[model samples]
Target chain A: MLDTAFEALKTFDWGSDLAALAPIEEAATASHGKPEARQDLENRLIAALKGTLTRDAQDYICRKLANVGTAAAVPTLAGLLLNKGNSHMSRFALEQIPAAEADQALRDALPKVSGDLKVGVISSIGARRDSAAVPALSSLLSDSDPAVARAAILALGAIGSVESAAALQTALRAAGDRRATMIDAVLKCAESLLASNQVATASSIYKAFTDESQPRIVRLAATRGLLACASQPAVRSI
Target chain B: MSVIKKPTRRDFMKTTGAAFGVPYAITSAALGNSERPAASDRIVMGGIGIGNMGRGDQGAFLGRKDVQYVALSDVREEVRDKSKANVDRHYNNGDCKVYNDFRELLARTDIDAVHVATPDHWHAIMVIEACRNGKDVYCQKPETLTLREGPLMIAAARRYGRVVSGGSQRVLEDYRKYVAPAWAGEFGKIKSINVNVGPLPQLCNLPGETKSEAIDWDLWLGPAPWAPYNPKRCSGSFSINGASWRSFSDYSGGGMTDWGAHHFGGATFICDVRDQQPFEVNYFDDSNGKYLAYRYQNGLTIYHNKPKTDQLLIEGTPGEKLAPKPVPGYKGEGGIYGDFIECVKTREKPFRDIESAVNTAALAHLGNIAYQLKRSLKWDSVKQEFVGDAEANRMTDRARREPWQL
Candidate 1:
């Protein structure tokens, strides 16, 4: 039944009867608690992804793979990342796979894709909060493309590691037309840092925005952040 | 604790007292003499997804003296224009604005708050974005599309200090008969409660139809995967049989979340576990048939579709009596809408605050995962993951289409 569904998936396009895909859905459901079964199902799904199929069929396969795909499926998924039509869905599947290889695949796609595709990859990296992407993301903060630059800043903020926060601070000094975006990203990093209990680091980021020269709302947010940092019970000497 | 005072309408009025006296041709309402608060004092509002429930939510806010409905947005041109006209007719002006994209509506700094009645898929994105833009939110019922969205939405609200309320009037109004009794301690030391709601959403593959120019089908799909725009695919009908977006997994969790929001939300509130989530979900499929028992951290269990059990059936210690406690209800005047507006003004949590709302919605999601896997499961509420279950964790959230992330 699953094989028949895979055969039907080859021709699956928009408006096709979804009933033909039931066996695959059942296989995905039944794969739970059965690691070997999941791996077999994932392997088949990955193979189907590499096969010739309609855009819809590929999209459907990507959705299924998102649930069960592992590192083994990353290379095939990564190959689709540079294709504009398939990049979003490729990243869609990659973002949820929760594997180091998937993160590496996205980071690898960063320099390879440009425009909206680049922005999408950066976002997928942020969604995964892959700290290792901080260096690559920071380098794009001053990209000529405003959207790409803004996305990189936001992605760095989402990662919110000590290094990501430092990268944002460097970008903040010359934010140019992306000033508001930069400030929002910095505050986002501060919040994330504060949540992760890096109070001192979060406080430094917040203090930079609290000057009278900053916008009132920005100052207010910074002040709030500073107050939050102050409220954290200080660590005693061990 | 140091208190930071936000500049409010009252603060503006105190500083601009001279300008009020010099105002020319001011209407009675604008002058604050006709029982309505002055226009400056009223909360400026907008509506996103102005369809069935959106239109009703618009009417509720539009009719309020304390709310100033200034704009409406919907992907479909037909409803957007109609909603704009309704707001214009109410305010006696053409100032009402309409947008094809909700982002533009949220972009307006003047909009103090927004009511989102979009499909379940758009709720988290719109609400979080609205909060990011400094607007309070009153999102329609089933305020989440996936379990992962709940925490993100709650975090956004907290980070921005926004008053986010889940839109489910029925949770309190229709279920009050049970809630009041339970809160009043009629069911002393409640052991468990049963809630029956489901037929989870299924995958949609409706044949593509000629896309309507009036509706921006792409915008309507938003973060959902690209699909052919069939009428039934985007229909707002309540059916869960592939006839409406409610029936599709891409947009909703079928009745499991659609009506489950009301049923599960009401059950949790009645049992006083609205603030908590189940740590364990034990599934049974035997002579009694398939059902789920959700055990909360507080020892109270919520049974879902257990055979021979009526909905909202509370089982408690039979002879134990307890002291009556106060039953919480909506603040201010008009039901849930007023509660939201009042909370917006006071900076207080709304009746169905996002945390409790998310917890309530989590029940449905947990049950869905349990039923889908056809086995028992454990959930770590704090970590917000399926305990040691890789396959189940993957289902916590689906990959959103590009440019849309929490």
Candidate 2:
């Protein structure tokens, strides 16, 4: 039955009859919460990724890997990151993987991909809050393509930290008409820092906005951000 | 039980006036100096804003043979006529009165209770006015459009000493009967709660179009900033089932505040954070929608998480630790209905009263403020304002256009 299910999966059409795959699904269900049993099931999914399967079949494996994919699944998903058709679902699964290798794979994919795919990779890095991507995101802040530059700004915001805040401030010089957009991202970065209990650093970002030279909305936002920092308790857990 | 005799015209006026703290002279004048019955053995209901939820509420109230829907009101001519037809069908006659304006219905001296299901903007004023008119109110969720409205609703309910239930109905009698055990026992000392009520509201960007003639578009736009009517903006989909004035910032807070009330009202109680508030919110923009999150001083986190596959059943996934058994032919946790009827009889607060709805809705407002500002807000929940954030504080109340001003 398992053999039949795997064979059926090789050509899986989302629109096709899927009842034969019940045994495979049951096997996967039985393996849930049992990591060792789950790995065997995950291996089948991983093996399916390497076969001559339909794009739908690959997407199915990628989604399943979101819950069960591990370090071993990283290399395959990493390779898919360059395959335009598979990159999205590849990043989707990779984003959920807890391995440092997976994070490293996403960081490596950032500078190599172009257009929205590159933006997607950048976003996934920030989703993981992998602060290591800060230098990479900062370099892209001046990228000629406005969307890439905007995505970089947003990713930096998502990975909010003293370093990312400084990177954003440095990019502000290059933002020109996109200054408001940059300010929005920086405010978010400041918020993330406050949430992480780095009140002093977050307060510093807000304090700069409070300067009379800033735009009125920016000043108001900073003033409010400063008040929030002042109200924090001694500890934090976000 | 001895059947109590109904009050005469003079006694009825006195009873109604006494219930709402209105002077007898004013009460009689509002009733057009017509003879009126002060009390009735059966509940004499007049539904105001009988659009979607308003009609649903009437259906529930009608389940009791004793509920007599004497009058119906809606700004739209079609809705009022349709609702009036439903009411007439219940009585098996054309005895139900209909009106395009709610104030006309409220002025009827025979009405003992009201069901208000207006758009988000009209909720506070209608509910407050109904309370003043000495009618018990079953208002819809998101009891107020702004923080200012919540207090006014509470004041009216208290001042009038009328039974008022804000419609986060899950907290009413059936809600307590089912969810109480889960809170006290099943979900032992809940360390955290995930509301999973979906994302923050987005700005209304429904493509514009020509307005319709059947709907009173201007009346529907009551109090909201005047903008040209679009079919999407008006009676949306026309079937009361499909109408949604929610996406627009003018009328509603999208799905966040709408369903958030249902989830937040119960989550606060289950998490043992009732009457308390989460200190700050943390949001991550996921491009598709925001991953909105909040942190309470007690170390609990509440946020929206779209459920994964196989995570829901017909009665659905039990949250925190709710295990509600399916009772055949039973409407889901008929708590708000039970509370309203009981309160009307006893002249007491409904179990899920205005104050509780106000608190839960306040949380949703906070989340909206945080989302709008793209920052975490340090809320002084006691003051009901952001600590020093005027911009965030300003968002707590929208500027109502003239005539709708609070």
Report per-candidate DockQ.
0.55, 0.01
TM-score of 2: 0.52
Deviation of model 1 at B193, angstroms: 0.6
lDDT on C-alpha atoms for all candidate structures: 0.87, 0.70
For model 2, the superposed segments whose C-alpha errors exceed 4 Å read A1-238, B1-39, B170-181, B205-209, B236-243, B284-290, B297-299, B306-334
Q: Given candidate 2, what's the lDDT at residue B305?
A: 53
Clash count, candidate 1: 1
Model 1 residue B149 CA deviation (Å) reads 1.8
For B102-172, candidate 1 gives per-residue lDDT tens digits of 88989877688999999999999899888768789999988998998999798778766789999889888
Per-residue lDDT for B111-177 in model 2, tens only? Answer: 8899888878888878876865667898888787777678667755754466788886554332354
Give per-model TM-scores.
0.93, 0.52
True contacts kept of each: 0.46, 0.00
Instruction: Evaluate residue B322 in candidate 2 and report its C-alpha lDDT on the 0 to 100 scale.
Output: 46
